[model samples]
Target chain A: MADIPIRIGIIGCADIARKVSRAIQLAPNATLSAVASRSIDKAANFAKANGFPPEAKIYGSYESLLDDPDIDAVYLPLPTSLHHKWAVLTAQKKKHLLMEKPLALNVAQFDEILKACEENGVQIMDGTMWVHHPRTYKMKEFLNDKERFGLLKSVNSCFTFFADPDFLKNDIRVKPDLDALGALGDAGWYGIRSVLWAADYEMPKTVTAMQGPVLNEAGVILACGASLYWEDGKVATFHCSFLSNLTMNLTAIGTFGTLHLTDFIIPYQEHEASYTTSSKPQFNELVTGWVPIPSEHTVTVNLPQEACMVREFASLVENIKKNGAQPDKKWPTISRKTQLVLDAVKASIEKGFEAVEIVS
Target chain B: MADIPIRIGIIGCADIARKVSRAIQLAPNATLSAVASRSIDKAANFAKANGFPPEAKIYGSYESLLDDPDIDAVYLPLPTSLHHKWAVLTAQKKKHLLMEKPLALNVAQFDEILKACEENGVQIMDGTMWVHHPRTYKMKEFLNDKERFGLLKSVNSCFTFFADPDFLKNDIRVKPDLDALGALGDAGWYGIRSVLWAADYEMPKTVTAMQGPVLNEAGVILACGASLYWEDGKVATFHCSFLSNLTMNLTAIGTFGTLHLTDFIIPYQEHEASYTTSSKPQFNELVTGWVPIPSEHTVTVNLPQEACMVREFASLVENIKKNGAQPDKKWPTISRKTQLVLDAVKASIEKGFEAVEIVS
Candidate 1:
């Protein structure tokens, strides 16, 4: 007999959830079991608009969705302020969790949520879809090659998108009471994560926030940057903004090579993604040109990144539910490290841009 | 009648002089008139190897070359410590100056050179060749466009090259007694110049050197970075190194657009140079990709950028020599501003990475 797919329910109909909802439908190992919203009309409308299965339940509240024993996993896309409560509750309910990024408002809250997941033996992974892309794996291979890339020396990652007037005035990201971390939590998460990914998840010794951060009237960050320093003299800087043009760049330089890509967060196309690498390039006779130019490598994707994320999450869920396997610590560990660095940047800004030491 | 090409003498046998000597020959408005070194045989061999014209003279010492009344200008490519003495004498000889950069050991010394040029009515332009590239002008047009680029917000510039062990031990750039400024003067000059060019040559309010700069045993910097902050909330950063793979990148983000290029200091190809620009890019439906992707533009080069630099410098010299016009102040002004910022970064590093205010 064919194995049953993991039954997944999404709690909260966030705008991003619409994308995840489609990903869940596309993933072969997962099935959308239900969706929840505070209002029954919203929940029912979201399910119908997203083409949910006819049998997929529509719960009026997130608590009702978690109460359902048939739901094997919860995809939580609530505002960051609400992540701690909903994420911990989902873990306590024994559901594998696909949590939205900035995993929680702070590392302490994330630690509590992580503890709950461990106690319940549930797998938890943040919804950073790009890391699951095939292209990312290819890039990682280049970074890991000792002869090609050599020792990591520096990395610079940036992600910025100009927020329209409507978004600036009405979006939850700008409201201090809502997504209080604003641009740092929302956009900077990718930059910091990319840096960590390049450094092989080695935490930095200190974080120094750049001096001039733009903040909204309610004290929510609209733009910011920070520099990270490691014990081995490796350094990295990242900039993120909701007030500049849409640009994503990751540049990692080593003793022997450089890796560069402009569209790291989201591919310019759905089918294939590309990155450029140069290994020990030499100058021409007159130093007028490169003798061997940088090469661009493309990875063809069989499935979109989000769907791949769903497949991976569901596969882990199936292993634990059917084969009695232990939860994987790799995913949650990386998420925690990303969150810890994010917290350091925020703390450095709060402390008048002083360098904040990262103990962990 | 065709105008006479400006007769240019090279003052030192520095490795860079070989390239600049070739540039002088290639420029339509300039000619290689003579070469000078402490050893007569070295000067004669340099002139012959670089294919200097049969009529071109070879001088046993820099003083003899400066006394050559036939030479209309001098291209001084001496070490940082020698720039002040040689450049001032070249100006006193009534020859226009095309001096290699880090114009002097400090801004004060640069100011003395500038004063000598002013007193002698001789044109002065530092050897920052990339700015002479036609592609640079195109990038500037985008940055200047009010609708397309909007307000300038941030810029990041980097230039690095892997130096061989012999060079690390023997190159003048790594010797405090010779160049003193080290990588900051050699490689960092390009990064700092690119940042200033992107910012329209505006002076920053303060400069903060990054904490973990690498210095040689003789207290000469091998790698360093700094952040520049403007009063209007604009910010920029630059990193330069002598221990990393050869990589050059300049990224400038405005409110409505972004401008990026990987080979800003030296084009990957001589015949054509390219940069990428994105104006008001939008995310595709579901935010999986971008709509109306960033565009790459290429500018064909009729003459190499270094030759273009020689041509521009020669043309300025011609106007003063033939038309009896005053020397242009634009080039020296920008050069001064660049040196001022460089001085601030050096000061910040000496001050334990403290923020150093730019009084200018």
Candidate 2:
């Protein structure tokens, strides 16, 4: 059965929106319905420059797009400070919401956004695209295998990128009033999400910030890390930065096996992704080397990860529109948990790097 | 120079000694001269099992091996409690010393042992075989390359192995009177050493132990970790455990590059080793993947890493013997710094996981 493509409208024309606009067009079930910015010409220019379809409407402001009856879903790529305000508006407008990460500056704001979506009966999901990659599903198979990966033990997820002086001075991410959480909310969202994804969304018992966290003049974290400990003895750590060379590394170790990849958050190529797994790895006699070497596993990327995210969101919206099913709780639940841990990390850092207990 | 092989004697026929005995024999400038244990039969069997030369002597006690005037050096793989005693005795006997790690239970005892070696003018080195591997040198090349690696930023080293119940109860490592430090001394040694090696032997200003460290009923650490903070903003972390599957992972990130290896303490195959390097890696236009994928570098292992350690130790001994040169200070200096950091970690744990400062 061929379902009608869900009409998608861009709520803000951030640089990331260009990629998401492309993803919207690439997603078979998603249609690029509208583009919106504070300036009508800027929105039209963005649409033309990003290859938005000719029929895609260009609105002078986000308020105009929100009021459009033709739009079924809104993709919000505004600064994190604006997420609470716009996400609630999108939900209240009866439009499904697919928003950029760091869903809000804090968990309370995130819960308020989720509450709006629930009351309006609208699907809500954070735009953490990599989780939708086919490679993620393939890696999950290995993690679920008792013989190969065994019980979960630890995880290390790192996401960092070198930001030039110009970005530090002008990018909305570094502005105190825009993306106030700074690296913790921007790059660290992926690291925290990756850790939660690896742990199967089991929230940690506590988070302890690492020492020597760097801060900009406005007290925004430029680089920071935290260690998360679970009741089951599984520990995880993540480091995010805006002052280092671009790097994405993820490692998950189980009782019987280990998984490693240099670019887990994003594949080196859009068409393919790879990871290494070592099952029951042991050093050979004399401990000079390993016995059963780790094997590399590559998964074909059927579609760009962002496109997969759009397709998945649109499919969920379609199910709700056609079957009268309740909005999927999985995505919102994951987004909330990631936000909770992020809050705990910030609290720990504020408390002089003490271990902050995570009640949830 | 076609120098004669330095005669080496093994004190205590521990399991590790079996590996080192073979290394002594395999080294071009090192010969296995003797074996010693509480029982002459045990020593004889160990010598025969390790393929010691036909002329290799067997001693029923360590005292007898120490008295052997023909022996130029002693490879001590004894328990942690025995290090200070045997190392001082071996040095006093006018023989060079190659002792197993955790140089001593604490820095004070380690210094006492060092003093004995210095007074006797005997060369000393810890038997951390991985550093002698050719792969380590190759990895250092990438790290030291100004264009490729830039200045160091951070390092993380993890070494873990699953120990069966019987081993946990019966192994010398678990015994208070034997290898009392347990996993911290055994596995954590490699982790700490790797972190120090990556930092080029710069001692950290502070060490903070991670929370939830597991300790056996005997009050010995079974699993633990610590973060090291340097004065120059370079940070390092290490985790070691006896409750996880065998794993050796090391990651070093610099301003412009990153290096990753799954088996840094030991290679996956004895004949060769490989590591991944990401030099100035960046994302593609849409951030779907990396611009340049991290490349894998492999180095052939011409000699077993352990043999390389033995050869290097013997050559230093030969230099002191033939050239009448003073014993090299480099090895002992590095060993002291590693022990200092280890002591700080232990102190942090003992102080209820508080940050312990390291003075020099």
TM-score of 1: 0.99
Q: Write the per-residue lDDT of candidate 1 for residues B229-310, one digit (tens) a residue.
A: 9999998888999998889999999999999999998899999999999999998889888987899999999999999999
lDDT of 1 by residue, A90-202 (tens): 99999999999989888999999999999999999999999999999999999999999888999999999999999999998998877999999999999999999999999
Q: Per-residue CA lDDT of candidate 2, range A1-360, in tens? A: 467899999988898998898999899999999999999999999999998889999999899899999999999999999999999999999999999989999999999999999999999999998899998998998999999999988888888888888988888888889999999999999999999999999999999999998889998888999999999889888988888777788889888988887787778899898888988876666665677888999898778999999999999999998888999999999999999999999999999999999976
Query: How much TM-score does chain B earn in each model?
Result: 0.99, 0.98
Give the winner by TM-score: 1
Task: Give candidate 1 regions above 4 Å deviation.
Answer: none
User: Distance (Å) between predicted and true CA of B236, model 2?
Assistant: 1.3
Alpha-carbon lDDT, every model: 0.94, 0.90
Error of 2 at A42 (Å): 1.3
**DockQ for model 1?**
0.87
Task: Find the candidate with the highest lDDT and give its number.
Answer: 1
The residue pairs that clash in candidate 2, if any, are A290-B267
